[model samples]
Every structure is written in structure tokens, then in C-alpha cells.
Target chain A: MSATNRQIRLAARPVGEVDPEDWEHCAGPVDEPGPGRFAGRTRAISLDPAMRGWLDDRPSYLPPVGIGEVMRAGSVIEVTASDHPDFQPGDHVVGTFGVQEYVVSDGRGAMKIDTSLAPPSTYLGALGMPGMTAYFGLLDVGALKDGETVVVSGAAGAVGTIAGQIAKAKGCRVVGIAGGPEKCAMLTDELGFDAAIDYRADDVRKALRRHAPDGIDVYFDNVGGDILDAALTRLAMHARVVVCGAISQYNNDTPVKGPSNYLSLLVRRARMEGFVVFDYADRYAQAARDIAAWIADGRIKVKEHIVQGSVDDFPETLQMLFRGENVGKLVLELV
Target chain B: MSATNRQIRLAARPVGEVDPEDWEHCAGPVDEPGPGRFAGRTRAISLDPAMRGWLDDRPSYLPPVGIGEVMRAGSVIEVTASDHPDFQPGDHVVGTFGVQEYVVSDGRGAMKIDTSLAPPSTYLGALGMPGMTAYFGLLDVGALKDGETVVVSGAAGAVGTIAGQIAKAKGCRVVGIAGGPEKCAMLTDELGFDAAIDYRADDVRKALRRHAPDGIDVYFDNVGGDILDAALTRLAMHARVVVCGAISQYNNDTPVKGPSNYLSLLVRRARMEGFVVFDYADRYAQAARDIAAWIADGRIKVKEHIVQGSVDDFPETLQMLFRGENVGKLVLELV
Candidate 1:
């Protein structure tokens, strides 16, 4: 085991796009598990669009990461030492373990994972927060019905891919909207999406009208902006717009652009609802079992873009999400 | 009865505000009731903000008023002649009778109203479509709970007055937003709203925060411009925004200013839903009963700005609604 741990701490509150100077990389003495605690080495860290929201000094589902504090993150860690009763040495756990090489926890909000079922990275990707987010955001908040047509924005991202697949598994026709032709092709060709719209190449509203000719019954929004407005214009009667995240607007210096065509909700008798995944913590195990079953049956495919790096690479890897550089679940795997 | 029926027809679709040139004042021969039909003399016409949306050629809850057609309006009429089974002379009825001095109907959408309980103009205001809109939009779409904090925009207008009072009747703390001080004062003093914000005089966001310090549980949005944005910022967790109308943006030549702070919905885990009151057609009777009981018990107050004029006055009276010139319900009563 390493005698020292490397960590990334927030140095400044970003104005718009997060800058390198905003993060401070430093080394510190590794924490030892005291009474009723366990220590672990982080194997993988999740890079999410929601991370951008946490960097701002504002109120949200979770409190902002304060300056001089380790950046808040969801990661998979392997236990190295333990004074806690439940956790043992070598057990893999998933939790909000922050952007660090080592962690000490009291088992509050930490869950032990079976590495034999899937790798540690898979837990951070398919069986972790993103998976639970797509599960409840679509099925619960979205109130999705079988055979309904669904349109997913940021379709190549973590939650979007899972949301689209869950819709397909329920016998619904799914259309994906992603930034590039390659991402669009991956959505349709590999992920079982009924159709894909390269937002960079197509007039999204017109494309949506053609692909979802009957109008989208459920729009799982991850990239909010003109794409959300496009989805609003093509909603069927009583459509459900699931407000999951707004990756496109996360780095904006100005205000988040609201959907101008949102009044279409009135004309179509539709609704737009926002939800946080943590609210469904009690049902995470059930959602995981269902997701696991789908993966085993070949109905759901796990997609992860693993970048091998140290904790210092987190700031750049996170920027990739806003720039739409990575596909599916973007993760940092420490060597 | 007069030898000719005076009518106001749509001349051209207005680009921004409806101009005098957009209306055609003409006279037509009064038609007799045909087989299985009825004829009536228009008693009072309801002026609504929704009329502007009907003038625009777009897909909406209802069809646009075609050029050269009688401008669509909801009015109360006194039955003068009938050939149908359910019709009789001297019975008062309400329906979408258009901006005309006389109306011929097959009794399709007509409802017989009791003038003994309320005046004919009151039927066009408090006991009519506006009343039902407030009832269903607040109780159903808003999912309002007793003792909750409720904020209403356009609170001195027809629907707003009723909505505010209904919220007050439910034992909720009601805050109203209107254009001028008089309208704001009317909301608090006469209509039973707990507080009022004059958007023209005060900083709306600051007023909302001060009035609804704990956060707004239900926001019944009737004017969806900056006021809607202001309400969005003050939402409590699990808030419901009922998009009843956007009178502020109805006549804008430019695109509607979308609520820039709408992402507050995500941060607060709230929802914004839109509904057409016509969808609750089957439940209007029940809703009207509740509203009527409240009014009778003095828990609700009826306010109307009645303009006594002929059919030629319809154009000017309708404009009073857009200018925020009238308080409570604005109605043109035919002499």
C-alpha cells in the first residue's frame, strides 16, 4: 500500500467553463481507518455532467464542493484496512468517495459490491448512480408506458444510454440525439436505438418530426437547450418530459436557456418534471437487480469510456463531458 | 329584435398588438332558427387574453379564428326563439357565441344558466369559463394542498381573481402578482389574497422571496414572462407550476421570453405542467358547485369591469384586457 495519497481539491469557484487553475493537485498522508471505520484505495472515479453543478456556489440537490476541499465524486474503491464490522480487506465498495487515491469511511452511504459479478468500473458505470438515475428518472418521474415513443438527448452519455435502452427493453421505439455522426451511429448501431439524429448535422425539430412522426411520448432530457425546445415542439398528447440534466448549458457564463416552446405542454396537455436520483435510495437495490437482469439477457449493453490517469486528470476528463468528447459512461481508471 | 345583426369579423391576423384595422364592423340579416335549432340575442361578451392566441395561425388547444369569420368569444345569450327539444324562450344560456349581436345554435355546446342566482355578465365572468379554469387549474393540475403557499400571476384578472380566492378558500397563504397597484390592492383587499406584488412598481423576484420566504408550494402562472421566472426562483421542494396562460407574451412580436431560471425546477425537484380547462368538461359542474358555494359564503368575491356598449365596442373592450386596464373580469355587455 502507498504511504502517501494524491488528491485534487477545489481552489476557486469557476465563472463559466472550469479552468485548470481552479483545481489544486497535492499529496497528503494516507488516512488510517480509526475505530468503526474502513480505509480504501480508489480504483475508478465517475465523470458526470452533474459534477459541473456541484462546482458552483449555489443551492442544489447536494451542497456545492467548498473551496480547499477534495472535489466531490462517485468512485469505486478497494478496501485495504478496516476497523468497521461490515467492511473487510479486499472488499470493493461504491460511494461518494471524492477525488482521491485513498478513502476512510464509517459505512454511512457506502455499499459493498461483488467484483465477480462485474468489475469495479462497471459498478461506477452501469450498476451505480448513473444506472439508478436513468432507472427512476425514466420509469418513475417520466411515467413511461410500454410501446410509447421516446426521444433521448445526450444519447451517448451515461444516463441517456441507459434511459434509451430501458425504453427499448419495454418495447418502445427510441430515438437518440447526440452531437456527432459517430456518436449517432453508435447509438443506432450498437445500442438498439430505433433511430439517431446527429444534432450537429440535422435541424433537430425537423429530424424529430421525421423520426418520431407520431410525436415523442417521453423525452428523457440530459442535454437541455435548443434540443429540449425541439423535443417540446414534437411532443404527443400527454407527453412526459423528464428533466435529468442540462450538460449543454452547464458551462455557460450566462443563464441556462429555458425552453421557449415549453407552452407546447399546454397545447399537447403534457408535463415536465425534475427529479434527483438520491430520492430513490430506498429502491436502488431493486432497480439494480432489474438492470442486471436486462444486461444478462442482452437487452441492455454496458458502455464505458475508460481513461487511464492519475487524480490530476479529473479536471480535464470532466471538461470532456461538456465538450461531448467522450461516449457513454466516462470514467478515470487509476493505474 | 333589430332588423340587422351587428357583427365584428377578423380582418387580418395582427402581428403584435391587435390594431383597429384588424377588425371589420359589418351588419348581416338576422337568421331565423332552423329545424332542430335555436336563436338568441347576445347579452354579454367575455373578453379574454386567450383571444389573442386564437388570432394567431398556430396549432393550439383550439383552432385559430379564420380571416373574415366572426371573432371567436365566449358569451351569455338570452334565448329569443327555439325549435330544439331543450330550448325555450326567456331561458339564459352560455356558449362560444362569437362577437355578434345575435347567435344561431344547434344547442351543441350551450349550457342553460340561472340568472336568478347571478347576473348574465356574471355568467360571462365568475360563473363561466374563467371560473372553471381557476377551479381545475389550481385543484387538479396544481395539486394544491391546504395551508400551502400559493403564488398567482395576473391576480386581478378574471381567472386570477377566482384562482387566488380558491386558494384562500382552501386555507392556503396566497400571494398575487399584477401589473398596477390598484389591481394589486384589489387582489389583497377584495379577493382575499394574503399578499400582492405590483410587478410594475416592485422588483418581482425580491417581493416573491419576501412574501414566500419559506418557498412557494404552488405557483398558478397566468402571466408567463419575468413573473414566471421570478416564481421559478422561489419554489419549494416538489413545487407544482400550473401554466394556465401567458397573457404577458400573447401579443409579443418577438418570441416569448422563456423563464431563464427554469432550471430551478431541477434544483428544487419541482414540476411545471400545462393544461386546457376544457379537458375537465365532465367535472365542470362539480367545480362550479364548489366555487359557487365559496362565493355564497363570502369566502370568494366577484369582481367585474363591465363596459356597456353595442357589438361595435367589442374590439376596444377586448384591448382593455391586453393593456391591463380592467380589474377582475372584463366584459362587453350589449345594449
Candidate 2:
């Protein structure tokens, strides 16, 4: 066992946006597996915008992380030793294994990953939790239909990339909203989006009006706030607004302000439903299989933005998510 | 042809609540029906709270009543003569025949009624348009299920009365919100509700907590404003809030105030949907047949409040509604 292992821990509660001071680097000895526990080394750590919400103390679908705890993260790891019968040494496992190079697990939430079909990093992106989330959130919760116009915000992010692709595969006209020209270009050129609106420069409402002239049938909202209101104004009758994430408002110091024009629900007879992907854990394999099939057929493109860094870079990498710097799935490839 | 006929015309638009000055009595000669029409003597006129919305110039699901027009109403009339193949002399018909002593129609929007089931007034009450509204709104839009807890506002009104009875017949435990002790007593005793809350005297939230201690499954809201918010707070997971009519807020001079606690929809994973009864016109006959079967089998009881008056008494009879003096269905029987 290694005498020294380094991990990033939450040093303080972040205010507004996360700062480097919010984390503390610690070194400790890697532990061997007990009777039921297994140990692994983290290969890639996922950086999701939802992590910002987990850092704040508030009422959400999940509880916030306590101070001094290993910062919460989803990771692709290789088991070096195992005691559990369901797993073995040299098996690639994926789970919420925290911000560390080495992790020991009881195999409670870990899942064996196939490195042949894609790679360890793809498990942290297109064929993993975010992909399954986009699939279920769009298809099951949104109840998307063929030829329906889909408007997705945070369109360059992990879930958004897969969501836009899945909608396109379902015979839908997809509109992507992202931050920069390059991201918007990637959405249109690479991700098969019909239209891409740079939320940084364009008026969202005007862009939505122009791109989705028939009005939005399903608005997959990852960036909430003004974008949500803009989408609400352009909803067709019986439209469904899927609240997958609210990256824009998650880091606010004050009380989260909701959209004011929500009466559009009554005016348009539309519905807005919020769901957590964790709710569909048992059905994730179904989403993964379908997504993999689509990828195999060249109907869905996989995009993962991998950053090479040490475990100590976890705090800074998470900050990149809130700043809208990373395109597609943002993940830290551990050295 | 009857030369003597009297009608009530809209005199002035009410700024808030309808007052006596808002109505005008006008006399007109009763015209004879043409080759494809029927002449009916107006026996009873239904007074519904929704009639207030028709007076406004704003856009609604239905067109607003034009200035200086006959006040719109659902009428139970006895056919005196007919050239229409579907209607015959001495046949009782229900139509949107306005507030008048006589009406002539070319068989359009008219349905023949059988007086053998109940009395002529009950058609304007328990088995009429309000009854159909309650039936379809509760069953189809609300998606009510057996043994669910149903909380309805305006519990002593025509539609509310039948809605509670129908829910009871479907094995739902019903709670009603009314204005006074007498109305509440009738809702519990005569209407067979599980409990009744008098909103005028009692606190709505506390009453709901006491009556529906397990949380509400379906909320049939007829009176909006604070009552809607109160019900929204008590909704269990996946609860359906049916927006039938907002009687309490109909009198507001400014824009109707929306409920501030609507974030509850997100919290409960519930839905709040608004529907106009006219949307279900194609399925009214189907709803009527099912509702009639229940009434015939003694599963549901009919309640009617009849007020006998001359055509000139229309103005005064309408005031009885705003005063909350009538129970069940408030029908003005032209005597």
C-alpha cells in the first residue's frame, strides 16, 4: 500500500462562486481492503455543475457536503484489489468515489464498466450518469415526440450534449444554447443541432423565436433564470419544461429567484416537471444500452472535454464548470 | 307567436363585483321559429359564477359578451312547437337560451331532456352543464382515483355539490370548503362529504390539516386566491390541482392575483392544470351517460335550489349569487 495519498477536501463553504480557498489539500496513507471493502485508484473525476449545489447548505433533492469531507465527485477508477465476490482486481469501476487518486469502497454504489466499447473516460461522459440523465429526462419526463422542437440551455455541457443528440436521434428539431461561438459551432456542426444560440451575445428570446418559429415543444432547461422565462414565453400548447439543472442560479448568495412569468403555464396549458436522474438509477442500464446503440449507428456523437491534472486540481476544475469554460462533459484525467 | 317577452340585458360593466346597476330589464316580442327551428318557453335559468367572466372584454377560452346583449345563461325550457326533427312540441330542452321568458332556436346547441329522471329544475342543477363540468373536470382532468382524498372549494355550489357526491361514489374521502356553517353542514350531511371547512369563519390551512391529515390527493379548486394556496400547501406527491373557476378573484378590478406558493408544484412533483369545460363538448354525452348511471343506481344524490320569480326579478335574482344566499344550483324559475 502507498504510504502517502493526496485528496482535496472542502475547507469552507463557498460564497457566490467557488474560490480556491474553499478547498484544503491533505495527504494520508492508502488503506488496504478489509473483509468486505475494495480499494481502487481514480483514473478520471467528473466535474458537473450540480457539484456547485452540493457545496451550498440548502434544501435540494440531495443533502449538501459537510466541511472537511472529501469533495463529492463521480469517478472512473481501476480496482487494484477486491474482497467482494461481485468485483475483481483490474476491473474498471465507476461510482461517487470523491476527489482522490485512491479510494476504498464497500462496493455499495460501484458499477463495473466495460473499457472495450468506449473507454474509462466515456464512462464519465456519454455512456454514464449524465447520458442516462439526458435520455430519461428528455424521453420519459419530457415525453418528447417526433418533429417536436426541443430547446436546451447549457447546450455545450455534459448532459446537454447527449440530450441534444438524443433528441435529434428521436426525429426532433433541436436548438442548443451555449456560451461561446466555438461551443455553439460545435453544437451545430458536431452535435447535429439544427440551431445554436450563443447565450453570451444574443438575446435568448429573440434567438428562440428565430430558431424555433413553431415554438418550443420541449424545453430542456439546464441553465435556469432568464433562459427559463424566455423558454416559457415561447412554449407551445401542452409543452413540457424539463428542469434538469439550474447552473446559472445555483451559486447565488441570496435566495434563489424563480421565474416571474410562470403564469404562462395556465395561458399555454403547458407543464413544467423537475426530476433528479438519481430517481432513475434502476433504469440506467436501459438508457446506457440505447445511447450506446445510437452512438454505434453514428446518430449520437460523444464529446468529452478531459483536463489532465493531479487530484489537488479538483477544486479549480470544479470552478471551471461554474465559469462555463468547459465544453461537452468536463472531466479531470488524474496523473 | 307570443308578442309579450322580457329579457335582461347587461347594463354596465362591473369594476369589481356585480351590483344591481350592472343589469337592465328589456322587453322584446317573442318571434316564431322558422322551418328548421323550435320555440321554447323558458322555464328555468341557471345562474353560474362563470357568467361574470363573460361580461369582461378580455380574451378567454370563449368570446366575451358584447355590449347591450342579452345576458348568457343555460336554460331549461319546455318546447311549445318545433319544425326541427330532433325536437317536438311538449318536449323539454336544455340550451344556452339567455335570461328570457322565451327563446327561438334552429336546433343548434340544444339538447332534448327527459323530465322523467328528475324534475325540470334539477336539469339546470345536478344533471345539467354544471353537473357535466364537475363530472369531466374531476374524472378526466383531475385523474381522480378510488380512496384518494379530494378537497373541493365552493362546496355548496351547484358543480361542487355534484363533484363531491361523484367523488364519494368513486370511494374517495371528500373534504369541502364552503362559506358558512349552514352550507358546510349541508355539504357534510346532505352532500355526504367526509368533512367540511367553512372558509369564511375558519382558517383554511388548519381545517385542511384537521380534515385531510394524510395530505390531499386531488384538489378541485372553484374559489381561487388564498384557498388555492392553502390547498397547494397540503398536496401530497403527484397531486393534481384542478383549476375549475376562481370565484373569489373574479371581482378584482386589476389583474387577477396569482398564488405565491406555486413552487409547491416543484416540491410535491405534482401538477396544476387549468381546463375550460367547452374543451370537452365532444365528450359531454359520454360523461352524461356515466353520471346518469351513477345517479340512477343511487350512488349519487341530486340537489337543487329553485327561486321562483317573474322575468323582471332577474336583476334581483342575480344578486342572490354574489350574496352567497343560494345553495346547490341557483336556478331562477320563470313563473
Top TM-score: which candidate number? 1
lDDT of 2 by residue, B238-304 (tens): 7888878888777788655566455456556677666667778898888888778988987777777
TM-score on B-chain, cand. 2? 0.96
lDDT of 1 by residue, A63-179 (tens): 999999999999999999999999999999999999999999999999999999998888987788899999999999999999999999999999989999999999999999999
Q: Residue B5 of model 1: what lDDT?
A: 92
RMSD of each: 1.1, 4.4
Q: Which stretches of candidate 1 lie over 4 Å from their true place?
A: none
Query: What is candidate 2's CA lDDT for residue B170?
Result: 92
Model 1 interface Cα RMSD in Å: 0.9
Q: Give TM per candidate.
A: 0.99, 0.82
lDDT of 2: 0.85
